[model samples]
Target: MSFLACRVFEKTESEKTESEKTSPKVQKTTIYHQLVQMETDELTAGDVLIRVDYSSINYKDALAASGRGKIMKQFPLNAGIDLAGVIVESDNDAYQAGDKVLVNGCGIGEQYDGGLAQYARVKSDWVIKIPEAYDTRQAMIIGTAGFTAALAIHRMQVNDQKPEMGPIVVTGASGGVGSIAVNLLSKLGYEVIALTSRKSMHDYLFELGANKVVSEDKLGMSDKPLGKALFGGAIDNIGGKTLSNIIAHTQLWGNVASIGLAQSPNLEAKVFPFILRGVSLLGISSTNCPMPLRTKLWHQFGKELPLPDFEAIVSKEIALEDVSPYFDELIDKKHHGRLIVNCQ
Candidate 1:
């Protein structure tokens, strides 16, 4: 059967050798994306074939759609990092046909075919059974974004981070991951400080359980090696000077979980926070997280993390054909919260 999918293609130009490397006339790549009908056999070879029910948009997916970042490692592949569905068939004995499953990362949207289609074929090893407490849509709502947030919290707690330490700052506080992080942290009893550059989102952030909302421009954070200790720790989405500033201002022995680099990836700050304050910068990589820990975290979402305000976190839900426009919205900073896609 044929199904609809958003396929991303990469166009390349002639390459220049070492001698011409300095020239602006070097190799260049252009990205193109669109929705098309794809036959089941056209999918990449995999042990499990899933009828995708729901998928979600993330900054990473926006990167894929906008051609701004090198998100998809392979061209002409589907473009979604998270999906929830039921198995249509399975080659592995561990999963039978009709099993409910979900997938996040595992190189699906990057290296292999992904979940932007009405149907998907993926490795059996990459699949996780849908939690009993949630259906496909709810699973996608908590998709990769929530998964990464959980990872950050898990790692921070493992290193002894506590609510008693101080308020936990969540940068990019109105976006998908940040919104969920604020809710989860507050629900878990930590004081949550929502930090965002957008002045318009303060009320929304407050409604999401932020103890306080701080505007980036007003904060006037310093670029010094060490600043006044403000927060106990942070879950930072916007990187660059913001991350550096957060690092400088974090309390002693706190953990700063670095997730996204919306501002910039370069960290050009001093090591005073690390050396003097015992602050730890935890890197969260949801793409290739080990299956054991990944499954455990997904399981915890239905229980400990609970995420009672999940419905409030959804920014919009669209069909596969309408997925392209929201990418630009995300890159332009005109969108906040999660955007889910209904593949079927």
Candidate 2:
């Protein structure tokens, strides 16, 4: 080798030694705030660094992943809302290297580095040790969508809703949250009526345990503000006119949990249902849910909500690099079910 080349090699080795002696920080890069590249030293500082094994894309993830919605507060950010993995390093007393953990929402994939990459450095507070009955993949299969579904159900049940009270309607029934809600509600003995835009999903929704399947157009409002009472309660995933129609049709003293806005964000509804029939509109925000409740819900998911085949909800899986192509399909509401990401 030339003398200058040999000297450069020696200098590079010396620099590596120096870097090792002093822990170099993580340095992640972002392209258009959707695609993320994370190097060992690029991760943000935190009590623990996780080697993420899996993540899944939700509708919010589609928005951030496409750079179409202003959901991301910062640019050049990691953009997955859910992840499960093993801890590689820890500064907190509760966690150690190799401890399995999961993270969802809590401003991740938006205000902070998220789970799309193979590694993530996150606050100890944000970590939830994987429930005993669930592995990393199982946890990812449940993901944020399932977690939110469980939370919504728990809230309604706590408010005294019962299966015998009446049939429960789930809007956007083919999507992740709605599908899981249908399964869960049915498993718990509540009659489940699924609402979807596609008649094609009727059989699949039935297999997932939906007692009845109805089209969105069938739920359309009439000239009169209030329609004949149809459902006992509902899990309304489409927040706009569909929700309005659902509100108009709910039985007296029924409850509706508003979660997604696949159709639109506007809620064009009259107060007749709320005031006349004593219907309740329960707003569910799963992102900032308290840690205690989050842990409890995850435990319940592993126990009471276990699907016979978890992969049934996972309609597709893609490599980390291939995520962008699916964004258009998701944003246009062409995709059904959960899309898992394999970060390894």
Candidate 3:
């Protein structure tokens, strides 16, 4: 993925090295990814240019798309990690015009020009031919969260976690990653427990196949450093104290997959869980995950990760023009599940 070029490239060699050592470069530009007129010169050099049909608002997207966090490691940056659309033009032999494809991660949102706009020119390697089982709009509904969820589950299975072991807990249950994890774990026959701070989502979580829905505060007990064993395994979205607490309470030989940090970055935990119980804390970084693994996981998402009604997770849909207002809502934890953006 290529970032929109905004710098003049005039620094001395020493200054350039120092800058590279210190921080990634950023530049200011008026290139709006939201409901703005497209200019001919805006397309990046690539083998494929897609006219996006759908893109979803992940927590990171809200941070980058709405200019909340400095997630634009490079600027004049386009900010979206997940996109599904049709190929309007292609120069690569592997793809032709009119083919449907979807792309998530691989720096599309963070540094490269991304899917939030009506047009995206990306390398052929970054595109995945759309799975025959789904369409563009449906793919965006699953998007990056679903893809990452699949990867986490795959890792757990590879580590020998099976449904017969015991219950699996998913934190931030109402959000994209946690919700998909809940449904996937449930479908795979693990007794599923959803941890959410929003009391209003109790019923909704159950609808997604969570056998029990518990308050996040229940996991936030007084810091005893270790607690009674509770979950057999877990997929954690909120890190910090909640994750530390989960680590303390995980069953013997249980694994905890750390996928996000919506709460706090710091993790405070005693080493007893790993030493005594052999608990595994697997760190999941989906962005730079190798291509072969990414392809396998996405294929799984298309074939086996289908929920009973994925549309249920789609709480709201917004036009490209209206996405900015939702950023504050996301930061305040006022919404649930996935928010798809129809870019038309």
Number of colliding residue pairs in model 1: 0
Ranking the candidates on lDDT from highest down gives 1, 3, 2
Q: Give lDDT tens digits, candidate 2, residues 57-151.
A: 88887777665666777655677888899999899989999999999888888777788878887999989998788788878878898988888
User: After aligning candidate 1 to the native by TM-score, how far in Å is the CA of 254 from where it should be?
Assistant: 0.3
TM accuracy, model 1: 0.94
Clashing pairs in 1: none
Candidate 1 segments whose C-alpha is farther than 4 A from its true place? 13-28
Could you say which candidate leads in lDDT? Answer: 1
Which is the winner by lDDT between candidate 1 and candidate 3? 1
lDDT of 3: 0.80
CA lDDT, candidate 2, residue 44: 53
What tens-digit string does per-residue lDDT give for candidate 1 at 1-344? 99999999988897767677666766788997899998999888899999999998888888886798888877789888889999999989999988999999899888888888899999988999987888899888888998888899999999999999999999999988998999899889999999987889999898889999998755656778899998899999989989999899999999999999888999977989999999999999999899999999898885877654768888889998898888888888887888889998
RMSD of each: 3.1, 10.7, 6.1
